[model samples]
Target: MFRLFGFDVRVQSGFVVFMVLIVALYGSEFGWWLAGAIAVLTLLHELGHAFAARSAGADAEISLGFLAGYASYRPTRPISRARQAWISFAGPFVHISVSVAVLLAMGVNPLSRDSFDDSPASFAIWWAGPAIGLMNLIPVLPLDGGHIVNTALDRVLPGRADKPMIYFSIAATAGGAIWMFLNGYQGFGIFIAFLIIAQLQLLNATKPRPSPASPWELAGRALDADKPAKARRLLTAALSHPQPIPPTSNLSMTPARANELIDLLPDPYPHGDAGNEYVLANLLMMTGRFDAAAHYAAGSFDRHPNTLSATIVARAAAALGDHSTAIGWLRSGADAGTSDSGLAMTIDRAPELTGVRHHPDVIAIRRSLATPG
Candidate 1:
């Protein structure tokens, strides 16, 4: 736990160490004043995001790093691509505004001019602001620019955002590294290479596991199970191929067979089977097939009761005129205590559980849910 600008912040161990190293090195090379200034600037940059998120009625948390900061907010509502793009651009917007203001002051005022001269503090502020802003604007995965690119691509191409953002990050990082090396910025070059490597590892880490069954096979298995009819229907909708599969009893019927069925499903969700359930549940809800929606939503909750799925189930149950069931599911979510602002917003907006808004458990649930997406 940490505190900055009257707000509580949390820092991971690695992040704490990174911040300490940055402060120590900068303070040693320049002075405590310069280090402190940079810290303040970083905080302000992140605060811009926090402010924007809060304005959007989202829960926000700030995380500070050695050379970076982020304001994470829960995305309770469906944010359009343009909104997402603006949110991504907001932090740099603040930094750039400050930079321009400072530069102008220095030019206009004699006192400010002296500060901008040979002093390390002036130099750090002048360079760091633009540098940090531009760095974050780089179209790479895990950066603000990457997010902007993702949002833009999402608007134009829909499903193609993530891959392109990743590819762009890789290409840009590589190009930046080469440019840095040629410009005699060996330290910067090494840093860029390290960043690219880290991003590569992240990409590999998030890669989906290969599935054994096709969707149709999984649907058949679900049908064979002694589940409720509604559950079977939901599962069938979820597991069905976009294109019709030829009906046949000769297909294998084991769990392995179910795996084969999923493999046959076309254009499966990027997050794999778990994501498939989410898409299926939402699709049912959108179609106003409340019973089927409830079934898949419940299935989603059972298999992966993350905030997103849980909230969906809760809402679906409410919409199905099962207020008790919706409230119960929401209470269960309150107990799970997830930390996603988006989920929190969803839960908060649930019609069935409005009475519990001020309850301690619900409030705590809200706090956890406040974390940015």
Candidate 2:
């Protein structure tokens, strides 16, 4: 790892292996000067992305690998789609610009060509920048062009564009690899195969699983953002889901905020009472409405008996200054073999529960949590 332009740049071991292989395969045409030039260009291209991201007020880190480099940007919060698109395009823009400059120099300066006559440096000057730039422009997932495509699609389609773009990357890479092999560019063909594999891994990683964010959860987000209309829309959508939707343990909003969100939902909802009630209970407790939260929670618990509902009820009762009820919930959960470590930790760390932390019953619950069933 090294720091360049205040960005942490990590060069993976595969990068050195690639450089060595390049030298070994075409050492006669790939001298030290040419190799250094390619390396410098790669770093500069990545820097373009890093600097662009930082300019956009996003924190950026870069990683350079054998065949490619990546720059990751994490904004303090979400950034505008246009700003994201600019950051994605920045690297290729810098790379292609350098390539053009090199070409123009070679065209005008007679000595520039003659000085490196018959050397690998000549090949580097002609091909390195342009090749890297063009390859990066191929629309493949995890690639700069792929990112550009996704960014554009996201602007138009929002959440519906990612999978299709990834599929496109897969098909494009496969076709490119086959074409490269048929045209005697075996090295390039193999590289595309590697890229194909990488894309496949990414696809697997992003495969749709059960997301924690139900309509109620999304509504909570909308309410937090002071957009009750959006929250209402989300809740309406949540009401449409098939019955017996499982409770989510991933509630992120506090009780106070959750109640505000619940209050915003329009009446005459179309939800299955069990799941919606449990979710509502969680929201209530998060906003410090412990008494009402406990009422909703008890009903949800009688029907569901899951770790999530139990945790919500226990935490709510404790925050309402009722350590005994909290202890009872914890004890019953443990006895029934439904309690979870994550739920226990949530209760343990809650600021509202700080008053009960050293209480004997709370310590007993903590001990129960530490012991395996």
Candidate 3:
């Protein structure tokens, strides 16, 4: 792996193996040049996407593997549909442009070439770019063109685009395979037939998927496997995720054990999310860290001011004998729940709030929550 234009480029074993196979099959020096040319062009193709993704505020890693290359990117934030389409188009755009330029410089007019009149090198290079690039523009899933089409479909139909794209890809692949076979391109036809089967699998897979587990979940697994050190590392990593989406609750470990693992960490903990703060606040409360729990809960409430955060803050404050603080938080929670039908103030019945449940201000907030709208 190396860095180019600020993006990491990883040449996988499969990439090298495939290129080596090409050389062995041809049994000549020309095969070496041909493989080298394809690798360069494919790198350039993936670079287009990497650069485009960078411009869109994403970090992209280009991985050259079997068959072709892929640019996997993680956007700093949600990318707009139009930007996604443009990013998908970028790879093929660079591919076609560079291929045409090379062909023209080699004294072969790509636009005028209906048949292959050029040398094997030019023919192979052309196929790598203009031909494959154009093919990639076809609206099929897992391909550049397919992604572009999927983005457009999503823009127009919202969340209802995946099934349509998969269905269309199946139809297109099936039809293209038939056309290839009819035109005496048996190899390409067979490839397209395989694509049809892949698309059918994709069609069947168009359903809701659970969110991937966060580092916290992994930490619990590490502990379960009797790897306390690994659990500690994962727990720390979870706190420092650039963009964390922690699970609603951890089932991997009990609150007491999780808190103990966290306490083992070295000081000056990593920056974290409100999700982490709220969850940690509860864990702190469970482990009898009332003051620390109040601090974390209050910090979370101040950042996002959600009912959940407010409830935790109130509970912590009540446990700490700060009834005034508890009452203030309960009021804020109730006020913020106007849209949720007083969900915030409905916490009067919570067992954790029993210490301050009879406080006048707390009771008033609960009365409002209990009032018929």
- Candidate topping TM-score: 3
Candidate 1: residue 9 Cα off by (Å): 1.7
Model 2 regions lying over 4 Å from their true place: 29-31, 106-119, 209-373
Pick the winner on TM-score between candidates 1 and 2.
Answer: 2
Please give each candidate's TM-score. Answer: 0.51, 0.55, 0.61
342-365: candidate 3 lDDT, tens digit per residue: 343335355667777777776667
Report the candidate with higher lDDT, 1 versus 2: 2
Which segments of model 1 are wrong by more than 4 Å?
2-8, 13-16, 23-31, 102-117, 210-373
Lowest-sum lDDT 10-residue window in model 1: 241-250
| Model 3 lDDT, full chain set | 0.76
Q: Evaluate all candidate structures by whole-model CA lDDT and list the values in order.
A: 0.64, 0.73, 0.76
Residues 44-94 of candidate 1 have per-residue lDDT tens digits of: 778777777766766788987544566888888876667777777888899
Report how far residue 304 has shifted in candidate 2, in Å: 28
Q: Residue 62 in candidate 3 has what lDDT?
A: 95
